[model samples]
Target: MNEYKDASKESFNDDFCSYLEHHLTRAFANAEDELVQKVWCDGVLMPFFENQTSKKSVNDTKRIVTKAWIGQDGQGEYELVIKFEKYSLRKYARGSSLQDCVPSERTLDWINIDLARRTIEIQLT
Candidate 1:
């Protein structure tokens, strides 16, 4: 994983969120490598709900969407592959701290956005 503590000073915006957003967008837009992350689903978030004392769903907006990329698992003959990841702090183990907040797994659900064909193919399996 790349560290954000030592990137170009000018490339960062005044707002930290904007800085992360801009960097994430640029990172996705100019990627020259293949990235296949471990996937997660609603099941991954289940423990949070199960352990909550209150009878409510997780309505908080404390997500970190810094990892976006084009995967390379089966790159040949594929086009316009991308991934937008959202970090889940609640997915960490009990008593885990900030270090556990980082993404360590990902899954694939293929989605194709063909600009020339102007068609979208989604495979939710």
Candidate 2:
């Protein structure tokens, strides 16, 4: 009476693939860079790692960025919080936050620097 008893391995695999594609599409909708999507598709999603976190050092501070979306504050300023080991930093933006998550490697998609606005919009494919 097991739920998977009647299902073949191939059928189960296909179902899993379909489910993955659906969730990937949803994730990509909010993604700002094609590189991020590719990394998710190849590394995280394919490997079944739903959540991921990365660390980077800037201005002598270790910053960490995760897969979860950091919601905006009441002042309409969106805070992109990153964690570095035990410490965390928050980067604020006026509009939506960009895809700045670190992949498996140290590579990062460089976006145009706008110091005046303090924002960077990543161009997604």
Query: lDDT (CA) for every model shown?
Result: 0.25, 0.28
Q: Write the per-residue lDDT of candidate 1 for residues 59-86, one digit (tens) a residue.
A: 1322211222222221222222112223
In model 1, the runs with Cα more than 4 Å from the true position are 1-14, 33-125
Among all candidates shown, the one with the greatest lDDT = 2
Q: Which pairs in model 2 have colliding backbones?
A: 64-82, 64-83
- CA shift at 119, candidate 2, in angstroms? 29
Q: Worst ten-residue run, lDDT, model 2?
A: 87-96
The TM-scores of all predictions, comma-separated, are: 0.18, 0.21
Off by over 4 Å in 2: 1-12, 34-125
Task: Enumerate residue pairs that collide in model 1.
Answer: 37-106, 38-105, 38-106, 38-107, 39-106, 39-107
